[model samples]
Target: MSGIVFAIPGDIDAPTGGYGYDRRLLREWHEAGIEARHIALPGSFPFPTEADLATTERLLAATAPDDVLLVDGLAFGAFPEALAARFADRLVALVHHPLAMETGLKPEAADTLRRSERLALARARTIVASSPTTRATLETEFGVPASEIVVAAPGCDPAPRASGSRGGAPLRLLAVGSLIPRKGYGDLVEAAAAIADRAWTLTIAGSPDHAPETAAQLRSVIARDGLADRIVLAGAVGPDKLAQLYDEADLFVMPSLYEGYGMVLTEALARGLPIVTTLSGAGAEALPDAAALKVPPGDAAALAKALARLIDAPAERRQRADAAWAAAGDLPRWSETARIVAEACLRDRASARNAARGFREKPMQDQRAREQD
Candidate 1:
């Protein structure tokens, strides 16, 4: 293979799960001696401006002919079919989740994305999904063949066991993710309000920049429900601060409407923190029953009930925490994720070469047949 060019649309170092996964994969490949490099595309993805799209096209077109271009789905799924076709043979789509499945899209916009993603995914040499939920969605909903997709779940880094609050002063609940509608921050705030009788403080550590309106709305609701004192939106934090936050957390909560794979859940497990999460997309299977209390997505009442259950019972929380720690050992590592993606890239390269060889030989074989005739 000439090289593997990882094309990502926004800041690769962004604290979001998708970017974190992409960053880790590239880092692992570099450490493992695999020849790979990053190509920064326009940040306005999933809805790029015309100028950004043109710039993206130029950046992609500059890749070496034989380089396997693994494009992140945020931009790839929104590319016009004509542009997608230009690099179809070398393109590999890295789909965290279908863009159309995002929580707050208008029907027409969803339809457009669904159609565009279907076309883009179909054209790519291979599709790499972050979870089986995503892979199945591509196969059934997006009309991509199962054989063309690879599921490379995000890896969890090992961490020290969180020293949860002792003697039960108050529960320390932590929810991490960008303040986007799809993360269900509103639902989480509502749920937290319902359980105000419980002695607990919730800290949501994520970027507010991803959705300023959602962040504002969350703040309004937190104040409206008289939870302003109990809830803290810590915005984004660096890795050290995040790790420290994780260390002090008593419980990990994720109320996302959907996740291709909940990397934070595994991170919680790595630190032996009990979990409360929604059964949305991969979140349903991201953690074992013993490690989490799961309720349906968007169900604030059910979420509040689950939160209460874990809050009132310290023994139960410890049991779940222990289970989480036990499960952590089985979580995929960054190295393994990199290995699977590297294998996929290599396989696509080989397949492309074989297809090109067949294309070259076909005309010669036809000419020979004509001469014999």
Candidate 2:
């Protein structure tokens, strides 16, 4: 068992969902006695500098030939076709989401990513998608064969139900995600402002460093709407703090434009918090309808209406929370996710070995037949 070499860009411990998934996957693989190692590539992925590209080539080329190379799509999707082709026989691509579908990209950049990712994915021996929706997109949009993709959704850890607010306290709304344009935090602020007449406060727990301009815009919106006191931006919270936020929250809201898989939705459901989320990307199907008041992404009015419904009728919120709590038992575990990837790696290595063995044996067989003749 030569094991797997997981190549990922940037800090593996970053608070975002993709980084969190990678960290937990590696941890679970190690716990399961699978020989898995991490290789940190340059953080400027999906758009690496020439020097960085050379460095990436050197780092990946250094891995043992027998080792399975599992590359995260953040960098893998952007690799030159020549680079991707080099490891085609042993490469496994972990695509969180296609880079081109990210919100706020210019048309030219999007097209470039789409072309590059299609080429890169075609060279992978196996492709691991974070959700079924992502798998479908890759198959239909990227022209990947259905057999090459595997869906390994993120797992959830069970937690105690939230205590919520006291009788006299305002409703506590919590939203967790990174402050990137794709998250649609600006729309969240707009919706929050729409329901200012109600007694509620929103706390958004996410790192603002990913997109400082988006963070600045959100701040401007908050000040412009005079919601400085009602909305709190708790940036980059630790796990303990996030758990506390979940515990104290009466409702969870996510207005993401898209998600490869909505890991935070599972986190909120694990805590039995009623949700108000948009139906965008995989997040739309992450939870059953009863668990959240769903709305179209970027529609502030509809989002505001849904928020008001849950706020005005606490019993409905309680009902939704009950549904979320019931569903938590069925959510996938981290161990399961790790198991799927490990199996994929082993299967790929076996296939490669067999192909090589057959190639070697074919010539010998031919030579023996000729001698017999």
Candidate 3:
């Protein structure tokens, strides 16, 4: 059998979460014996100019009907309605969440993007969401029928062995995600402030993508709370550096208000770090039991309490981290995700052919009735 082709318009050169997910899926597709090729669309998407649209048009025109086009949610936002109408029957959209509707977007922009997202979902033959949370949002907020949507949870790479000094010194806390309001970085800073008396250091890694004002706000908070020395802002570390941080840290916290899927949580669990996160994001699902410390979104007090409890009790932290690590091992690999996609594509194609044949037969039967009349 001919192999299936998967196309995505994302920055293949970048090492961000979305980029990593796409790369893993491609690797899995190849492992599953499906021929997959990824096309990196221009980095400027979701607000692509006319020239960018022309480039994308050329790329889409080059794709054959037999190929399975997997459009990334980021680029799919700007995907013209004409383009969607043209390929509605053959395309599958991989939504990581409604990017344009993120809290980071300006109010006007968010509204426009929300509309675009709904239209895209309506036109897509298959819509694959990375989390059940996001799937529910698509159905409730965007009006995507449950029958057309499938939940394909993101997979994690194998967890790294925990390597660090098992000491009585201050615990190290890590939070990873872009520095943005939606990520609840401000709340994290406040949590850090509340627990400054404890012998702990908080390291935040990731550049700000939205709410540039929040950076100044965080600086002010750090100064006022006298936590400038203890709270370190380590911006945009590479995977190797992140792995090192994970190994050195005792706990991981991501207090985001929302996420399509929290890949960072999976990475933290793989490194055997106990997690503290909010229930609003997709990563909340990653913690099946008490393995993670859960808190309400935007509640600095609750987050502070959760962090303090983990810091004060070394035994509990280690116990939870071990359980989290064990659970992480069971997460599906990229190869499994690829296999599912391929199977779904094959089934959809077969169903389409059957429907077409039935349609053709219907017209013939109608003509015979007219002749009898």
Candidate 4:
């Protein structure tokens, strides 16, 4: 087996869904006897410095021509033309989400990002998207050929069933995702305020540092709404604590405006927690109709109403939790996710090798024909 290098631009174990996926996939692949390894790049992705570019050049230059390099799109999608063209031959892009589509970017800046990503992705032999929704966007919006794109959704680890907020306890709501503008956390706060009359408390556990200003803003909102006690910003938590939160919680709610795959939703499902999330990006696709109550993105009023209804109906919540548990049985495992990506990369490597051989042979055949004539 040839080398498999994951060229991620930050810590593989970062407290986020995409990083978690990369870490799990690489670990699983290594366990399955693949020559998988991680290569760290500059952490300041999507806006790397000159030193970062220099490091990338040196690293790619050192990679064996036969080796497969999987570049996380956070860094790869924003690569300049020269950097991208240098190692384009064997590069495979792991696109968690399109950088251009993230919220809070100015139109001009978004266009620039779109252009750069298109160029960067054009060099990849194939783009492995986290979901079908992302794959479609790659083909239609980014001009990537449909044949050059693949979809491999994230996997979920099975978790202890949630104990549920029963026995006259206040309904517990959990929303997980990094605190960024795109996640619609403001909407979540508003929705929480709307349901202020109900017996519920909300916990948002995510990487507050990912967007510090947003975190501060959320704190301000919590204070302004007089929900400082009711709404707790748990900040970035470890796996053990997160699982404990899940086990103790009653409901999973997310107001994200978009997601590449919304791996947390699957995690929520794995724990048999009924969900109340907006129908946005892959989050909508991952959620089963029976397992969740879906609402449009940015509609705090509707979100609040949904929460209120579920709070009043204990039987319905129980039924939905049961449905979520049933759905968990069929969720993809980490091993399967790793196998899919490994197989895709290996398959394309072989195809590229065969095509190169055919190209080399074509001239000889043409010369033989000329001599016969």
Name the best candidate (by TM-score): 2
Tell me the tens digit of each residue's lDDT in model 1 across 176-239.
9999999998989888988899899999999999888888999999999999889999999999
Arrange candidates by lDDT, descending.
2, 1, 4, 3
* Candidate 4 displacement at residue 222 in angstroms: 0.5
What are the per-residue Cα lDDT tens digits for candidate 2 across 1-373? 5678999999888998999999988887665567779999999998899999899989989998888899999999998899999888889999999999998889999999999999999999999999999999999999999999988888776577889998899999999998999999888899989889999999999999988999999999999999999999999999999989999999999898888888899899888889998887675676889989899988888889999999999889999999998887676777667767777776555643533332343334434443453
Clashing pairs in 2: none
TM-score, structure 4 vs. true: 0.92
RMSD versus native structure for model 1:
11.0
Error of 3 at 76 (Å): 1.1
- Candidate lDDT scores, in order, read 0.86, 0.87, 0.75, 0.83
Taking all chains together, each candidate's TM-score versus the true structure is 0.92, 0.92, 0.86, 0.92
RMSD of each: 11.0, 10.9, 11.6, 10.9
- Going through the candidates in order, what is the number of backbone clashes in each? 0, 0, 0, 0
lDDT of 2 at 57: 86
Ranking by TM-score: 2, 1, 4, 3
Candidate 3 lDDT over 69-115, as tens digits, reads 77888888667788777878777888888876576677888877887
- Residue 164, candidate 3: C-alpha displacement in angstroms: 3.6
- Give the Å error, residue 357, model 4: 26
Q: Which runs of model 1 end up more than 4 angstroms from their true locations?
A: 347-373
